[model samples]
Target: MIGNIFLFIFATGALILLNKFLAAWLPKRNPKEKYLSKAETLVFIIFLLIIAVTIESYDVNSSVSVFTIGIMVPRQGKTHRTLIQRLSYPIHEFVLPVYFGYMGFRFSITALTKRYYIGLVIIVILALAGKLIGVICACMYLKIPKKYWLFLPTILSVKGHVGVLLLDANYSKKKWWTTTIHDMMLASLVVTTLVSGVLASFLLKAREKDFAPQKTCLESHDTHEELRVLSCVYGVRHARGTISLISALSGCHGASKPFAALLMHLVPLPKKRKSSELLYHELGDDVHGDDEFGTNDGLEINDSIDSFAKDSKLLIQQVKLVTKMLNMHVEICNATEDLRISIVFLPFHKHQRIDGKTTNDGEIFRQMNRNVLRHAPCSVGIFVDRNITGFQQPHGFDSVQHVAALFFGGPDDREALALCRWLANNTLIHLTIIHFVSEDSQTESPVRNTTTQDNNDVFIEVAGRDQTEHEADRSFLEEFHNRFVTTGQVGFMEKRVSDGPHTLTILREIGEMYSLFVVGKSRGDSPMTVRMKDWEECPELGTVGDFLASSLDVNASVLVVQRQRHSHDNFLDD
Candidate 1:
């Protein structure tokens, strides 16, 4: 009996050592290959098992002999580890239920007598107390997050499959484990497992939103302050294009209060992991890339970003997070609040192909974008790329990059113009301000804040303006024109449109002329976009953004800007 007990302890030590050794091999996998097949994983486990069986004493279970091998594998890069976790998740789901069910079937709960029940109660109390004390000690020893302390004890106390497998393996061989003893062990196992699961569920649910409060928004933000932007992205396909947009935003006329961004590249998380061993996110690296199925261009995405940052005046913090896709928005919102972000830049749900045809990437991604829009604490911009991964400069007398802001007079429009104010700082960037107004519009100072009355960029004088409603619009637009246009750094123009169709026509005609087009996500009750909603496909993009993003042949990319609107909504619950 003493030898048997010693073997159990000895085998456990071996398991730990092997797991550590094997875990170190994780980095050997491709950095871009974030997934592993169940078949492949199973073979790896089997290989470890065989090696462990060869090394360990026959008295200990083979599972126990190779245990440390599970923990000792090669250390993986953040992306590699995250990939395996996500890839191995479904296999865990399938195997866990099957394993647990088989164990449950071996138990005979109804056969226990009053005497056995009394003993069972004692066993359970001892088990709970022992695990709880051990966990409390570990918590004090290791600086684990205090929040996880609420559930880790119970989670660790939950009975595992290995013990049951051992009991069954030596069912008739062990003289100590009589039928009566076996029944009681299985019964106690079920009790502890059920209790642990319930407690963990309750605890985790309560702790889900323990994140800090989010209060910043772009509307009230200071223009002179360095913009703290939380830009969320997925995959490496659009990384360069996203960086290009960030480059444009980094320039300012003065000492340049450029954006200091926390660029988050999100990936799906694994289902199960050791709380102490897991890292939810880590700083992304500047790796190289190639176009292969398992090894894709994702590796090179950060290299481009690194190169860009090295040469540019922008401050960028790259982070990669591994989390559930459904609950990703919660993480984004938390990061926004933690970093006090002023704005969040999101990619459009639909991506434009080389042929100018647009296709919806994924409904899940779209839902995540909506959730972010609903819960984000700051201003948001949905960037729609139309072959603008490289925002090609027009070859002309200008021979420079042209940026256009289509203003329809609203809080969002004002924000778009505010961004344009910074774009004007880049002498290579020629800024054009296009105001879409109705026939009943008036301006006291229409003495042309604009220059070079060219075709399409003409100033139109109108009549019968709404003084009360357009008060803010007129004030902001006039200020923008006076400051930028009067400095001879910007071109200002006004176009009178009868309806949404006419406005859209005018926009499409001049869309490709500029390298980038900026527009407000809302039309601000303007009659110009009243009917545009009838054809609006992506409401998250707003009417104008939807028009440009969904169009089959618009070469210029669009940035749909939305200023934060104050409302009494829950952080994420509402």
Candidate 2:
């Protein structure tokens, strides 16, 4: 009892049409994430059953028929394939276990005697030995590291689910499989799966390294060394802002101070999609040029960044990654360590309206920023936007960027100054250093509190343990002042503030003059700023940045910088 061939064709065609329709209507981030709920899962299963009953020619297995349909359907576009996978996940989650359980029940344990058990064990051992031998020969030919041989075989030994389906199909055909032989094959499959899981756990434990918070910031890096930066953004618009910032950092391309950057654009992976996150060297195009990637994303970003890099005489590597928010921080940290990056620039996870107010807060993206700040392998900066992309290049004297760095004291503040130094190298940027000092404390001669570190690293400590580092503060500012202030491209000023309120007043007075404000996420708690609620709105911005990000009076953007956390992966700060 089966339907006509025409009906089968129509049902299959209908499924493909629906997938195409929804994919075109939805956004790239998958707005239909909840479309296939539990109720819809049953409807999907019922449709599959109807399709399954229509085809009498392939009566051996319904899943095999489904597979035939899957291979026939075209999966050319990445976003198109995303919708297909989203539609198919309900089958994998709810129907797969039931299918396996039904097949498992069909195997009769009472039919197996003690003699069959002995044969099954012998068969399993023989299969395991053969797999190990083949993997060893392949490893030798490939010249893989000896350390990987054990776990490598374990991974290869795990059989795929497709094989189980094929086995059931062959058994139904009554070709070579007897009842005893089929049961033994199923038992061996289960045994090998368990063994591989156990072996992999023990062998890979030593290789698993916990992510410790790092302190790999520019403050510790030698000033003469070539600076390396990893600039990350969420979309094309954000990419534009990063390119402008990188241009500011890429100043004049003098041989005396070289610079390198990697621009990474992140695309969110649709839920339940099994595609591995890919990091390609060039975005939007494979070697063939105009592949199924379809050039829908990042092409504009790549071209703009490439043109700027070429004009500036700097080599910028552009890359894009499709991944879930859960693993983005890990990928960022790993990339930082591999590239030996000095710092990472991240855009804040909010959109700015025309009135200079921030809205449409993306909490998931905010969490991503938090994780990166907590575990980044290098220094991390969150760039707040107030027309950051519209920041005109330093074309001439008339069109210049007014940049200011707020310095209190600490590793992070020093990092902000170091970055400002990079920005000031451009003749078009006017750099201003604003120092906040306590009203009672007087400016005295420098005290000797310099601490030398191994391998050209240095940590500055003031004479007093409880107060901010006054000596280190002056040393860094003096060097910056002597070099740039004389050139008229830089300005140095000090404001005596009694408390946090007074400090806010100073910021309010000077905030309107600057187009960009650079501040550290954390600084020494002096009497002037210790009372400011850094933890109120967003703790990740520290004291000054939190205020600047939320302020409606000032139209300037903010960059909140943090030095890399020290190496303590096992114990992360809450």
Candidate 3:
């Protein structure tokens, strides 16, 4: 029976991996990803029907066996498959918590009166210590940012359900005071969860208060969404936590500020920045560079700055919507070394778009940054306020194993690789660099027509060129492999050149195979264009990056490194 159960577990695990692979790799006929493909959906439905049939045919114990087997059946497609995604969450969240709580319930009060008391105390200490150790090791091992190192551990430490499940699976058959042990374990689990969650809440609240002043000069006032948005743009974890805290605080009805702080403790920090460069270009400008920032020659304007400013102004002009909202004065400025603008945020600002001619606050900021980047004769860093790290330990990866970096012989790309090198060590991430050469159009060439319609076919048609591209990819693989040979990484390297119409699109399509995107922050007069090769169209700033972040959708983030951190005393830095 035990062997059968083990077999069942293995089969179910394999099927789950297969399902995930198909979900990620299959081409989507519908671009929106609104519903699972028709064929997959049908298979999923059949899977459900088989489970239902098996349940009807078997008794409770037999049904358990059947259900275990049913999990192994392929269910690749189904309508609203993501809707089913929520179910696993409950198993992870609520059921798992209950499982752990039940384990705590297994402990006996009488055990404390016996020789077991000292051992139990040691056990409890060891458990907590183990989790903390894991967190610390992850941080030091991954070299995570100082701020993230705080909260990452607390959130990672909440092992309620899964831990309980594992304990039960392993100890269910034990007869040595088994029932008592189970109850005590269950009860302790409950206590641990409540206590840990509370601790997390308080830590986050304190961190927010600390960072609020640093985020923007608006320490005197309470307008924070703009700052939150900016942090989101930076892909900093602290920024994400601040946004959650601000959103939660703003929506709370009767909670005292202290209580609000307590609740803020439990939230996880943001993993990635908002990632839409276009929005910053658009809305950030409007807020900072209104008529106050005069545009000189060759200065491009963004739309977000104006949007943020205008929206903020409107919130103030129409105070009824946010009468209960806190109004603080936060100072905002572009830290670009070139043309720039700075603005003081008041509680209320107007947000109006009139025939494409309406002016607002964020738009002003966007325009100001653009003016600076184009003609300021220097770089810019927009500083809003200053706040920093949470109190909990950060969650870090085991070892930076298997890292991949994208390089295009540009400074930004080189800078990105340099950053990776700084982060690398023996036990850290294994790095792979891909440098692809795109074919330039042959000028005034006599064309030969071919019947092949597929793009992959075109690449194959060029025999010598195909060999050249493959050799380039292989050479990269050999170089990295040789470099890491002594580090117990038997091998490390992979590369490919995509002659696709859009670099960003190709990046997105194939990016999921890697852990993170390490592309350069494109700027200046570099020949590296954001233009989609297929259409010869320049996408808005941050378009490809944002879409890629959204599509990958799971534990993936993009890092946009500033060549140098711009000096700006206005925004917060903590």
Candidate 4:
């Protein structure tokens, strides 16, 4: 018997090593492969099943071998893990119910008695007490906030599927165990799962009332204070570009007033109802990890953030380094509605792959952007980074950072200009304002401009509403120029384009010269924008911004700004 035990142990260890080898080797050999093909995954599943059966044939527990193999499967990246999880989901959902039913069939309902019921109650009480006590102690030791104390313990006490598996394995191995014990164990599992779920739901609902207040504007009480920005990072790939953009906006290069950023890392919730707590716990741990503020230069660090495609730690660390070096205060948290922030920045979802085709997981990210735009209290900026991995100081460290704002006479354009004004305070930063006007609007009859009298004129003509709007825009622009641009602090230029094609050509030529382009989303139904409508892929990025984003060769990063809807009325008087 001892020799047989040794043989089983050796076999199990060898199989685990083999599984690990395959999981690591296969991905390394095919670096470009996002996931195992269906046929390949099928073969892997068959091989693991065969091993389980072989272990069972030898009078050894097959569950351990199967569980080990499952755990050994390495999730190399987000795309890889997503494919694997999605492919395995149907199989698990279909088989779990059948497996549970078979297990239930082995026990008789008639076995339930008063004595067994008493024993079951005692078991549940002890389990709940032990889990709660342990969790409470850990939370206290770690200095976790008191609000999560009860919720964490209650949720952690829930054990269903794993318990069922362990009971089934034990019953198979020890056939002599009585039916009453099995029934009681099953009953306990059900009660624990249901109780924990209910408690969790109640806690979440209660916590909703304690949300943070909303921020309606970016303007600080003191005009000289720092601008607070809330930047959202979806994954590690976009982290570098997002940080670079934040650095520029923060005016890190010798500015009197710097920007403070709340780096809200976005983590998608799992499909399961109780998965939210798991995400919260994971993020909490990440925040508490060593070097929470440590600077990491490499982008390939091994900081995993809730089973996503890549290690978000590397991204977070890089963001920390940039923010730290810039002397900015950076706080990390999961994205939520209660955040008191102005100007939410989101990274564009789709990216150019090695094959030159733009691809992403799907519309989930786009929907996130839309939701944030609809509900964000202040202005929102969606950044489309085209291969821009952080900013490089062109001519040593003293060189000026070229930033251009493409103004097209709208509230959104004005918001973009406002952001540029803050950025221009840095002496090392050069801001260029390019105001695009239609050729027709620019060459309007001079007689029309002089006839508009403010004093009471008896013969009032209600025509030329467009001209009045044009004059209003010109008035606002002149005031903006005199206050911000005319001091020789920034460069300003105006370009009149005949049509959409002409506008696109000029933007493309000039955009290549700058490091970043800031454009508005609402480019009022002008003929120029109307003609360029066919080329727009993402309408969220207005006509010019979308065109710039879609170009494969364009190296400049784009920030598509949209002002809050309520603020628009204040900017554009009837």
Candidate 5:
């Protein structure tokens, strides 16, 4: 029996190791990742079959080898990892249900007698209390916030699939425990898991009110104060463009109070069973050497900090080289709530591939953007890089960097103009404000016309008022032009493109002339925007910004800005 058990263990271990070796080898052996992913999937299935055979032949009581082999498989790259996740979706959705259902069938409810009921209640209470107490104690020792005390305990108490597997293993071994005790434990597992899930849901709903501050941060910000901006970059490739935008917004051109920039490097969490601490420790000896601005508070510390620490160590070395040359005071850290900043800058997910076709990194980046937008403490800007290699001059230099700002009159446009106002301070940057006035703004609607003279007088008065409002808009633009458009510093250009096709043509022509394009996100009932809406591929880039960023002929990097929604009341005055 002992020899058979050893043989089973040896065979399964060998197959798992072989599977890992092949997975690593196949990718190198084949250039096409699609073919390699298929080959890796086949190898995984073969190892699982071999483990099953070993278990049957040796008459092993547990199927723990299945779980062990899964953990043993190495994730090679994003393509390989994504393929594995896609392949396992069916098993997780369909097969797990059958397996768990079969386990449920073996559970005998009749075994729960009065005597066993007492033990079952005791087991459930103890399981809940023990798990909750242990996690709460750990959280307290770590100085975690009190708001998360109940939430962490509730989530940690969830037994989930592992609990089912353990119970099934015990039930398979008939003599492992007495029948009544085994049945009671299984019932307790079900009860505690359900209770924990309910508690977690309740805690999450109750915590929603605490997030109110995120909405208020932008509204309360004073534009006259030193601008505090938090810029988030996913990789080193995006660092240059993000820093450029920050430099432009920072008013880095000999300003008395320059912008304070906090560079937040974002990274996806590591795969399952991987220790983030180990990853950080292996990064280098000088991991925490430059983290002067980062805090040691345990409340904000989590697994993400390890990734942040690792990425920050790498990013600081690169960012410092640029920030130092620019003479900017920049702090590098992970994107977290510990630091409060007014504006957050994020890079667009899509990147131009070797074949010239654009591809996004993955849904992870898109989801990250959505989360930031949903809960960001202030205004956010998503920068789409078109690899504009034309304007490589250092920001605030005397060399001309032409910037085009698209304005159509909305809160977003106002915000974009405000940002340009800051950029206009630099003597090197020549700013062009392209004001697009749609045909709808010039014409009054006939829908409200009436035959009565009194009604006609009222309608005429309203039409006159509408014309006066249009004049006010023009007056505002004139004031803007008078303020910025001095001799050779700023230029104001107006385009009266009525239809969408005409607007696109005008934008295409204007886009070719500029090194950078800044545009608002909202269209504000503009007829030109309505006409161009059909051509919008990515609405997240807004209309004009998307057209410029996606157009091959544009040749300009785009900055799409959206003002915080709650700040419209305060910002409209500007």
Candidate 6:
């Protein structure tokens, strides 16, 4: 009996460490990997079924005693044991406690009237106090968020299993001292578990009220620079990923159709060649071919042979060149290193038509799955002028005010900077360009803010504290003062550095507050297509985009911009 008691006590201590490890491991598993095999599931279900039937059989004492025997069921093999171990936790954490607590509540007062009473009270108090101290230690170590503190005590409060185990000992013991100790311990376990559960639940609710809110700053000002906007510039491989406010106003008009058409228009087409008579421009001249093709090198390329075999590679290269000539941002990369190519391409296949033309939305969305979803960047968004959804356009501010511009080095970021430039130079909108510098960049691309004399309005924040950190990584935070907190010119333009949750988080937080969430369309489908493709490479965004899309809390209006290609009268007609 003494050995059995000692073993149970040691086992409970081991369970504490095991439970902590399980808690950390469970949250990280992929959904498919989180569960046990079908065979294990079946075994657990069968055990649970038997336990349920036994508990309801009205033989309460025997039913409770059977738990020990039940856990010792014949293991089919190591795999079966592993599965049983995985499945046991759910029953141990939830099912077993409730039954034990209820059973404890039914303890007889008459049976406790003898020598067992004092020992039971003492055990109960010690168990409860020990659990409380453990919980407090956990709280301190975890820095448990105030809103969640009430929940902490409940996690520690469970004492029913120990109480049930004590019951078996009480029955086996014949001596007064041994029986009394068993009864007292059993009683204490019951009282401590119940009291702990209630107190923990209440405290958790209290902590939740004090939960710290995430903080971000947003600012906006009146500007006269007309918002240069484009929607769904890049091609989206999958049209289904888009969520356009325009889609909402359109009254459930399939988002994919318009979204696909919007993307095709965004794909930068190859530049067209004009007849030889056009005047030469100094910029973008073909320096490499000047000696081979004479003065009018472009004029000698009319032969059938040149057109037939036509080094398909050269044509493609020329097409790419022309596309860049059209001012489309084109980046050539080693396709082998990054097997995934993330581009905001037309979401609809070329065959589908929209607006009296074919559309590509359906084909892209339906075919998308985990393997291909990350292989190619696939998010789609449609931009329409008239509210497809009931979104109202913002009216220009006639009162004239201040503006702040965020400087990040992407298309949308540059556009935001351009908007600020336009506002500062051309309109009533007072503009300040705020660039966040990291400690590493401070020594390299250091913006001598000393150039500005306007101390009241102009501001720059260096987000990084240490000098050794990567310049690209640092975010600027104003350390001592909320200088721009009340300033009217202070504005925040949401800039997505890469495809990730931070973009969504920044978008949701600043989306409604800013006059616009300045985002650059792929110039290539929907704004999200390029963004999502970029996200595929990032571990954080790939995990979070699905959840954020379903969340009710996010708020923001997306403004996508496509850079206009510079064209002249000499351009090809097609």
What is candidate 1's TM-score against the reference? 0.56
Instruction: Return the top candidate by TM-score.
Output: 1
Whole-model Cα lDDT of every candidate shown, in order:
0.67, 0.69, 0.37, 0.62, 0.61, 0.34
Q: Write the per-residue lDDT of candidate 5 for residues 1-574, one digit (tens) a residue.
A: 8887787778778877887677556655544332345655666677688678657665565467777777776533322443454667787889898987887887899988888888888888898888878988998897776778888878876756877777655344567577667778888999999899999888878896553244333323444555667776655556556655655665534556435666654443333433446676686743543332222221122122223323322111112111221112112212323354566777787875555567878766665565555444356677776554433334335556788888776666666776777677765677887766554343532213232432112211111224554554455555566667634467665556556688788877766788888887766455676667777877777777778778877777778887765332233242
How do these models rank on lDDT, best leading?
2, 1, 4, 5, 3, 6
> Which window of 10 residues has the lowest lDDT sum in candidate 6?
312-321
Candidate 3: worst-modelled 10 consecutive residues by lDDT = 316-325
Query: Between which residue pairs do clashes occur in model 5?
Result: none
lDDT of 4 by residue, 1-574 (tens): 5886677667777777775666555545544444455665565667777777776777666776677656766545423353455656775788887888888787676788887887888888887787788988999997776877888877776646767887776345576666677888888877877888898778878885443333344322232654667766656656656655655665544445635555554444334433334565566644533234322311122223212123211122112322321111112212223344557788887775655567775776676676556555477898877654323323234666787888776667767777776767655568887776666652432112233332321121112236655565556566667766767777776666667888888877775688778888877677656589888888888888888888765667789998765432232242
Per-residue lDDT for 166-269 in model 3, tens only? 44544444577376566556556655666567767777887964423332221112322222212212222223332322322222233222211110111112
What's the distance in Å from true for residue 384, model 1? 0.3
Clashes of each: 28, 6, 121, 1, 0, 39
Q: Cα RMSD for candidate 5? A: 19.1
How well does each candidate superpose onto the true structure, as a TM-score? 0.56, 0.55, 0.33, 0.48, 0.47, 0.31
Using lDDT as the yardstick, the better of models 2 and 3 is 2
Which 10 residues in a row give candidate 5 its minimum summed lDDT?
454-463
User: Residue 264: error of model 6 in Å?
Assistant: 31
Q: Which candidate leads in lDDT?
A: 2
Candidate 1 lDDT over residue span 115-167, tens digit each: 89999988877877888888988997976557767678888767566656655
Candidate 6 Cα misplacement greater than 4 A, ranges: 1-106, 114-120, 141-151, 162-181, 204-208, 212-574
Q: What lDDT score is found at residue 279 in candidate 4? A: 62
